[model samples]
Target: MTFKHSIKTALGGLHSNTSRSILTILGIVIGITAIMLVLSLGAGAQNLILSQIQGMGSKTIVTVPGRQPSGPSDFANVFLDSLKERDLQSIRNKANVPFAEDVMPVVFGSVRLSYQNETYQSTVLGGGSAESNNVMSDIFDIYPEQGSFFTASDVLSKASVAVIGDKIREKLFGDIDPIGKKVRVKDKTFQVIGVLGRKGQVSFFNFDDMILVPYTTAGQYLLGRKYFDRIIVSAVSEETIRTTVNDIEMTLRANHGITDPEKDDFFVETQADLADRLKTITTALTLFLSGVAGISLFVGGVGIMNIMLVSVTERTREIGLRKAVGATNSDILTQFLFEAVLLTSLGGLIGITLGSSLSFIISFIISKFALASWSFSFPYLGAGLGLLVSAFVGLVFGLYPARKASQKAPIDALRYE
Candidate 1:
């Protein structure tokens, strides 16, 4: 028989057992859907992180207190009090770090902000100097929508002036003007001088939900700690990032009296480094989930193999009749193999459709509810891989059954039930 005739006969055989065919392909459908969903979500998460990192610009460098965390056990280093005011001052000296364009110390803590009867718990960010305003404006593109940022005098006087985020402003003041109003932070009333424009999360920090204050004020009055959590530095140019990082390392080491690089209390990271780290983390997670999802495909393949074996047994007489009438072994093998491939291919297509629809619905719901950063993505690569894997599974698992069907002698098959 011709290849087309074999395919036609195989399709007819599947149609004759419609219920069984549907049941047999269900496993494949589930496996493909899981794989496609994992790939789509992974891609969306990676893109969100990369975009956030790119938004910060390439010239930015961050000096974080504590030893660089290398493993799960090293996470305790994050809470260490390593960076001090002396390290900030040493990095600020242009004579020592001429490549540094701007330096801003950051300290953050969760605190309650109250305006009369309304109270909200939110993260409070403290900026070390007036230059921090410019740093935030330039690197993070933060700008005041209603009023201007606090001036240099505000930082020097350890002023109780504050800049509120968009969400914070809405929750506290509603439609009323926030400028010149007072908000209570840690028993201290701070005059609202500025309201920031809508800036979403960056590097997992939700700017929209945070309030900004002077670092001196936070250290002295709120957190009551003199050490800084982190120091942000912008290079004079993108080309100067390495030099500035080196300068910062040298200055910080000297100030902290550290002789060995490995023994240094702080770790410096560039924007590129941060992007790479995030990408690595996301990629690892994607790979691990994909591996777990792959097990379903294996189960589906086994299901296909078992179903094909049953099909061969049930259609033994039909196969014998076809062989008795001039059909070759190759023809019988092709017919059975085509049926198996068709089953899985159709299942893969259905799975792709279902997975894509579900991914879109999830992304839409998350965006509507103002959840974490998420985007709907078409899993093109996942679909392609799924299709190829389905075809491969059909070939591998269907081979034994197809060969067994082809090898049965016509007289023996006919004599059997």
Candidate 2:
């Protein structure tokens, strides 16, 4: 039989039992759908993470108050009081770190902020002199929409000044002007010196919901700790970042009286290092999830094989009659194989459509409500792979049933049913 004739015969047989044909391909549809969803969502998540990391700037480096964590058991080291006033002073000295351009000690905690009867629970970021605030503004590409950032004098005197986010202002002050107002931060009252713009997120921080204050005041009054959680350092240029990181490391090691590199209390990470680490993590997670989704495809292939075998048995009489009417074994084989491949390929197309639609809807919901930075991503490679895999499953699974049908003796098959 011609290839076209075989395809026509295969299609006609499937049409005779449309319901069964649809049921037979359901497994393929589901498997492909799962794969596409996983791949599209994974790509979107990776993009969002990378974009946020970029907001920190390539010339930036951070020093955390602990050794690099090797496992969950060592994670507590991250909260240690290793970065103190002495370390901060040493890092700021140009002689000690010639390439360093800016440094800010950071501390943060959750607090209930109130304006008279109005109250809201939010995070308070304690860091920055006015110069450092400007550095932050430049780095994040956001500035106060109303009023101004706290002055350098604010840090020196531990002044009761606070810069609130847009959400903080809305929740506490309503439509009233927030600048120059007094708000209670934990036990102390602070004057609202500035209000940041509606920047949704930057470097994984939701600036729209945070409050900023001088680290001195935050340490002495709010968290009641002299040590900082981390120190943010900026290099004069991107090219100097490596030298600056080395300089900062040497300075800190000497200041802490650390003679051995492995015994160092603090850890430093540049933006490139952080980006690479996060990318590796995201890539690994995506691959793991994709592997889990792949199990569905294997299950679907088994289902197809089982159903095809049942189909061969049910059509035994038809196979025998075709063989009795001048049909060769090769012709019968081609028809059955064509049916299997067509069913799976059709199911694959349907699955790609359904998965893409669902992924887009989910991406929209997440971007609109949860995170503005999130975006929809289409997995072209995944769609192509899904189609090819579905077709391959049909070929492998349908072979046994096709061979069984073709090898049937005409006289035996004709009399059996």
Query: Which candidate has the highest TM-score of all?
Result: 1
> Which residue runs does candidate 1 get wrong by more than 4 Å?
76-79, 128-133, 371-373
Candidate 2: what lDDT? 0.86
Report the lDDT tens digits of candidate 2 across residue range 1-417: 998799999999889879988988888888788878888998998888888878878888899888888779777655489899998888899998888888888899899999989999999988775455475565556689999887677888899998899999999998999999999998899999889888887676778899998888999999999899888888899989989889888998898889998877888998788878888887888778877877777787788788888988999999999999989999899888988888889889988999999999999999999988899999999899889988998899888888998999899889876
Sequence-dependent TM-score of model 2: 0.94
Query: Which whole-number lDDT from 0 to 100 does residue 238 have in model 1?
Result: 91
Let me know the TM-score candidate 1 reaches against the reference structure: 0.96
> Can you write out model 1's per-residue Cα lDDT over 1-417, one digit (the tens) per residue?
787888899999899999989988888888888878888888887888887877777898999988888998787656467888888888888999999888888889999999989999999898847644466677666788988777666887899988899999999999999999999997999999889988787665678898888888888899988899889888999989999999999998888788999877889999899989988998899888878877887898899889889989999999999989988899999999999888988888888888888888877887679655678888787789889888888788788889999998998888879
Q: Local distance difference test, per candidate?
A: 0.85, 0.86
Model 2, residue 324: C-alpha shift (Å)? 2.6
Clashes of each: 0, 0
